[model samples]
Target: MAVGSASYLELLLASDTDVADFDEPLTQARAKGAPADQLAELERERALALRVREILIGHRRHQAELQLLNDTAHDLAALHDLDAVLQAISDRARRLLDCDLAYISLSDRDRGDSYIKAASGNISGLLRALRLPSGAGVGGMVARTGAPYSVLSYHEDKSIIHTAEIDRTVRAEKMVSLLGVPVVLGRHVIGVLLAAHREQRTFSGRDVNALSMLAAHAAVAIDNSRLLGEARAAADELRVANATTRSHAEDLERSAAVHERLTRLVLDGKGVEDVVQAAANSVAAGAWCW
Candidate 1:
């Protein structure tokens, strides 16, 4: 029995299978009439194997998250449109969190509210266009606090200030659990990113961490997109300014050429007719005449 148990343990270690393999070995050991002590040891081994499997799974998940972040950064850099960038952020977040829905709310300081900028997964138009006033709703709380907020049941959670429009949208969408994190730049909360489930579910610490990481990435990407837009606009303005300068320089050069030609005519003892004709031709060719 001891030999059999030992061999089984060895087999488990050698195999690529996960904790599911534990059941088969334990059953076989029992059929082999293994002693109680042996069975206890086997149970311990099973627990250890499960823990190892969990660690491996967590490592793989972290790797996947990093890859997703990298891909998102590349997409953000390549995408020029703000809508496209927001859409990419929403899609990546939803896929990474495996949530029923994910969306972003951009802060509007002038209006003192947050408006939906992007959304993914099963969602209605009303929910997509939903707005949350500052200091209202879970998203607004995150915006105000600059932290991550989660609720097992949004309607049941009274701690968060609820607005009629947000409540109506949540009810219409049938969302049970919601998580929101601030998309902050420095100390300022720029926007909020939310992931919601249709069924009641508790968000684990890891879940919150992953969502927060994604939010951080999104915030930087959004800022970069805005900066890129401003840079393009500034470049266009500079181009226009440069063109105007060039036009003025050309006018001055033509004026100086005309003056020199008139002086040369005077020095050559030419008549007023020659100067008049030259000035007319020069004006027609290069300078504007009023």
Candidate 2:
């Protein structure tokens, strides 16, 4: 046997003592010249151990990769600010998937449309300037479907139309593969997460799954940001309204005071001299005469 294979077999044998223990009595009998059957059993046990070791090693590597992905997702969830969250997600997706372009498109719910909120790499500037109506293209279709979609050849895909802005700027129809996943919160689709490769390539199922998970994180972050902004705006309006109400109340109180003084002067039936003196004092104090 080769050195590497021999070492792997040895390690496996050491780790699984039950196999060795079963072989121990057989080995002792063989030492006393018992039979060839006993020696064959020892070789069979060693083979089984090698197989188990290979399976165990494969499982361990898979588990380690899963743990790393989980850690990255937790980090994404920790971000609160909407812009930062989108940017981080886009960056991570681009790096993890080895895509040429990645972007997050947030829906403008009030306008019934969607716009790219953040992007990474050369397409970032182009995405920032683009907006798509609901159900317009791949991103919109993903939003409407609320599911993941992928195209291995975008140029050949008749459904995709290059935005006028993108055509004017990039001038390269180099993008060939595209994938989009909806960002959904509750029953509503909030946005779309997009990834694309420059050359025609089929996206793996794993890539789609990872992008979907990232989209979920983005949806929650966007919803929180919208709520926070609305709350601040409402607080400002309430403050302004309160100030207006107070000003109106103060004006009413001043008018009532003026009316009371006028009524007292009339009710007293003061002589001409007293009335004239009161009028002179009121005029001197800048009171308007009707």
Candidate 3:
């Protein structure tokens, strides 16, 4: 029993072993004419080992999620371009979930639609710049609602309002399963991050939660990029305004000096030709008086 228990522990610790693999030692003991009660004891031990494996796997998954969040925060701090940020996000989501592809779609308020901005695992590139109306499909609906949603069949799912372009693109790519989470800011949904599969598959709750967390990070990046652009634009406008103000001030000073010089000539008993010549010179030199 001691040796068998140790072997069970070893099997549980093996990274590649599964629940079916845990039966090796018990099978061997049974072949050696082990008593019924002893076999039952081994069965109980196997059940315990499987439970331990579940807990261990779950803990590791949780740790990975925390690490991914930290990495995304680092990306936001280190990268400036929106395309770079979004590509990193989509790549990470695709790799983490083991999905066939992952992509990002941002809402365009002027056009009242969402368009794919970045993608990973997209071999054909047909969907890279595809446009979807605000309520046209899964990604668009998520953008409108600011919620996470998943579907097993993108083509057959009646819940999604399929548009001609979106449906055609998806069908051409043979995409089946999809999950989308909104990139939200305060009360508005600004975009969506999505994962897809080429075949029908259900998204687990954990998958939904994981994508939601990633979408939250994406939202932060989008908001930061927009704010930075707005700040730069405002700074540029302020610079132009300041330059124009300085130019007008210099013009006013020149006009005042020309007026004072002409007035002094009149008070000093100078001829009108001298004042007129001075006025002409000032006018020629771009002086203005009102």
Candidate 4:
């Protein structure tokens, strides 16, 4: 069947011509005699063509999405501010995943707490005040495990403990479902990416996969932004140091000029005692002595 389809497809492709040239010969062939075999062949060709068309359409759609994703990644990477990148990531995730809330939390290693760095939706104000201890919540678990996690029912999940403080915030914000993925950079787990729905919703595998991809991208962007910030800071320090060194050099040059002038005055018959007193004053004030 495959071989026959291939042959018929080849014939059909051969029959394809410019619309202007699609005249007598092709019409007569179709009208006078399309045998059962030829008709079958035509049907096979049509089916193959339809499949190819669908495949092409799917491929194009995928390419367009990829391009869009790449563009977004590039834009995010161009942002050197950590807060800006986090905000962009959260906003994009909320929009793309169609979630009610999105947020990013960074681990406060010293205090053993996770604090929300950026969030979307109505909970932004509340999330800003929420904090979770290490190993306390799902987001914390993801941070500790460096893996992605989800809870369909935040209140019902035994593995997820809801602290009274956090529960009040959650209830006030009307959050029901939760998804969290760790942001890993090298061997370090930097933070967590979270998405929540106000209603009970099962996050599909595809949704998890997409969030994982976004997390990976966000991790790199965050890391790069940090590195860039450090680089800029180092550069600013170096520039300041250079300027200070130059200022010192100029001061030394001026001091040397003053010494030359004083020595010339003394050599040209000024009073030695008076010249000495003047030179002492200049030297005390950062001028060179003769």
Tell me the tens digit of each residue's lDDT in model 1 across 256-279.
878888899989999999989988
TM-score of each: 0.83, 0.62, 0.92, 0.72
Which candidate number would show the highest TM-score if scored against the true structure?
A: 3
Q: Count of backbone clashes for each model? A: 0, 0, 0, 0
Winner on TM-score (2 vs 3): 3
Candidate 4 Cα misplacement greater than 4 A, ranges:
1-68, 280-290
The residue ranges of model 2 lying beyond 4 angstroms of the native Cα positions read 1-81, 108-113, 123-125, 133-137, 158-173, 255-290
TM value for model 3: 0.92
Sorted by lDDT (best first), the order is 3, 1, 4, 2
lDDT of 2 by residue, 33-90 (tens): 7557645655565566557866776566457546655776788678768798889888
Q: What is the lDDT of residue 273 in candidate 3?
A: 100
Candidate 3 lDDT over 1-290, as tens digits, reads 78689998898778898778888989999999999989999989988888999999988988887787788778767988988988999988997777999999988889988789989888665798598887888997687677888888988889889988898888867789999998888888888999999998888888888888888888888888989999999999999999999998998899989989999999999999999999999988788655
- lDDT (0 to 1) per candidate: 0.83, 0.72, 0.87, 0.76
Candidate 2, poorest ten consecutive residues by summed lDDT: 1-10
Residue-level error in angstroms, candidate 1, position 85: 2.7
Ordered from best to worst TM-score, the candidate numbers read 3, 1, 4, 2
